[model samples]
Target chain A: MDMIKIIKPGLLTTIQDNGRIGFQRYGIPVAGAMDDFAFRVANILVGNDEHEAVLEATFMGPIIEIGFDGFIAITGANMSPKLNEKNIHMWRSIEVHKGDQLSLSGAIEGLRTYIAFGGGIGVPEIMKSKSTYVRGSLGGYNGRKLMEGDEIPIDASKSKAKVGRYISPGYIPRYNNNNVVRVVLGPQDDHFSPEAIETFLNSEYKITAEADRMGYRLEGPKLTHVKGPDIISDGIVSGSVQVPGHGSPIVMMADRQTTGGYTKIATVISPDLPIMAQMGPGDTVRFKKVSVEESQNILFEYEEIISNIKYRVENSFIIQETDKLYNITIKKL
Target chain B: MYEKARFLPAGDKSLIIEFGDSISPEINKKIRDMYLAIEKSGLDGIIEMVPTYRSILVSYNPLNIIYEDLCHKLRELEDNLNDSGSEPAKVVEIPTIYGGDYGPDIEFVAQHNDLSVNEVIEIHSSRDYLIYMLGFTPGFPYLGGMSEKIETPRLKTPRTKIPAGSVGIAGKQTGIYPIDSPGGWQLIGRTPVKLFDPFAEPPVLLNPGDYVRFVPIDEKEYKYILKQVEENKFTVNIALLDK
Candidate 1:
């Protein structure tokens, strides 16, 4: 029954969830949130399911007028969100009343920003996901970006948790103009010359403006292949750093096709994918190769941190509640 | 023939099993066999498997299964894979309309190959092409085994939007555009078949290891088939290939 009307649909805002899984075999891309870390955190802050669909805005953010009271959270990029002409902070939950206008300016720190509601966006799920594949015209708000004057329906369920819950400072990710991403050497590393591999690991690459949900095209040292870069067309997974005949490496992202013909020299680790997603045009990126064991360990450590946050929050909340109860009892006595 | 496969890490969560180095029928068959074998194994944590020309990409969840353990299981499955028991490849006949508004580049493809348009059509539809893989777009088939006589180079500048179901030839390969997308391949004909329909159960009409043959049709027939397809009354003519 709750809804928000878009006054201005900034840049490219679309609904995204965890991803459409189990459909890659049919060449359907696993379209999902570009920055999973921010997406998940936003949902968590709002007391919604981690995989719930959220609004993913690129560079710029939309201005929407709420029609009902609801809880909301914005994460990932800092777009300088303002509620009814008042400044709001990111990485925290906020409550909105009826007729409240929420607007956001251009991103200051990162490329994509995620905005989530308490009970998730009420969009029909296609192939078991709400992620939008714009090219295929499948899933999410009519399979396209939010346009001006679109009324977005939100789930009417209310959240029991109080608003203003902020992510721990320790868990906050740092965004910058330069990033050093970790990767694991390849499914097709042997196709590239040793010198080329060294160049890929040591050289600094700039993220080109052509970067999108499909892939990030990096402008850097020309990686010379021992043989041609063309391989027998093979499977491509997200974060696979594929080098085409042109020698430029394209880091496949969430909306990448299921298979490609280019040789992949390496793949970025899962934990470091957030760092890659937040990068904007002209952002400098350098690669550091790590072993498979090291990458897996990093992912395990990241998951451990996320899992601990919930327990820590619950314990703190319980302690505060008990202290208040004790004070009330003393007053009664 | 079954060849030794090398396992390479695609990322921390996925691995690629390279069966061979070439794009041949034998390599494609092995890829399909391995895919079925792994599927039949009922391996936990396996998210999805993509079958390509000479490899199979298996993506998994690291939280549910570790990388080493998955590789071990896959290796065991590969070793015990029974290729003989695998289902025979299906031959799918596609009704295509050649050389008209639908196929704008038909003349270019014919002239480039130094043949008449009718000859080009005959050569293209003669042999059953193998579906090497499905990629680029949903349901788009990367087909192999095009006749050498019809080999034509891709356009210098790619078209902004090639219509869906357009059968195209580029270099030595031919493929169908399952969705309207930008492409460089020379369009030789257009098929009325809906190769990709998101509302359908399978979504993609063809799969890797299947055989596709182009059956030429006139404009009237094309219109009739298009109507039937829109009504969901048209079924792709398929037959089990004899080994």
Candidate 2:
């Protein structure tokens, strides 16, 4: 059955999941949702497994109509999602049957938003992944972004979740253009001069126009290297701060290649990846040096939040629909 | 960490143990041994391990195994690293059709090195190149020990899409393109064997520390192997190299 028919593909929209793991050794990138926190929340709200696929929209979102009786929850960036020409709430689960239309305008806050169907996307898996890596043309919906009139398959909802199952406002992360992201130095920090490392930590970098799932190129103070900026090709994980010969930095992201030849000065922590992913071009971000322990401490806390969210919904989901549903008078557009 | 081995932090989830800075059979052998030991240890929380030419990047879950504890266990594994369980290195014979459209740049490589096309093929197929690591593209091997006679510079402008199974040489290096991708490597031949099948169980045909010997074949044999690969009936000829 056709789950989602794209009437209009807004910005860049692609299917994503937890990630394709265990194959990085074969030079396969672990392509997945950039904002994993939001991605997981969207899946959890619809009572789907944490790894199920969801629609990850960047900047703008797709105007899609559903052909299944299931649920949908929008998370991450607030794109002012609408159902049948009426405003729908973000970070909340809502009901819809076949022929119901869903659409999202431009993002007002975060850079990426996730629209998760009830049972998740039912696309054919490549290397056991639903996530799209466009550069390698592997996985997800035909290994590319959604196009107009494309009919996407969706797994039927096995979720007993009520219409009001939502995440509270306290749990919803806020995204800003000016943000501070944490970084842990290493792997190749010794390749840089001490003063260059200090420069990297102190300088404020703005996200350049070349930002995407592969990596976010940041323009800032040039980081000088003790030797030339080349390293023998090695495995690259997401959040690696690789400095090419030009001296600018690029934070390798989820869809990054398995290996790179440039020298990586530092790596951003996992907990801050979502925050970094939500940042768009021209956004100014300052880097703060944190130890692995301090960074891991935050990571533990972040994981704690996700584990507790599923049980705390329904009777008291965000904007708790139990008490009252917001009345909106639909206007003829 | 050992004296020559430098353990560097790659964020909270990964650790890079650099054994050396250059590519050699000895360093790669040590890496392969260490990789097998760590992989076979059944250590908890270890997600994946990528063995490069000189380093092995170990990705693990911090929630289950912190970097410190993981490093401690890795140290133990490193001390206990042995070659007892490792099978003898196998050489994968890659059947290739050289010259013509299959190797459009063979003439260029020949002229650059002052040799003929047959001499180029003779020099290229004479040795078993060590597979350093797979990177750049999926199943794309980083090979070592290419004959200096066949060495040539990469194209000034890279082709937008080089077909998969393209055998190429770049300067002091030579490798095959496992997938269709834009690259500057000078193409010299095309292999009929599929090095990467995303739908397969292992997906990749080559592994780190394996040796690849190119066996020159005619167009008929190339077409036969290509058909077998498409039909999923092609069993790669893997044999233990002579000790």
Against the native chain B, what TM-score does each candidate's chain B reach? Answer: 0.95, 0.96
TM-score of 2: 0.96
Off by over 4 Å in 1: A158-164, A313-333, B112-114
Give TM per candidate.
0.93, 0.96
* Candidate 1 residue-wise lDDT, B62-90, digit = tens: 88888889889988988887769688888
> What is each predicted model's overall lDDT from 0 to 1?
0.87, 0.89
Question: Where is model 1 chain B poorest over a 10-residue stretch in terms of lDDT?
Answer: B1-10
Tens digit of per-residue lDDT, candidate 2, span A1-333? 647899999999999998899999999989899998999989889888877999999998889988899888999998999999999888888988899999899999998999888877889988888889888778988889999999998887555555668776799898989988898997889889999999998889999999999999999999999988999888899899999999999999998989989999999999899999999899998889898888888889989999878656533443346787653322446
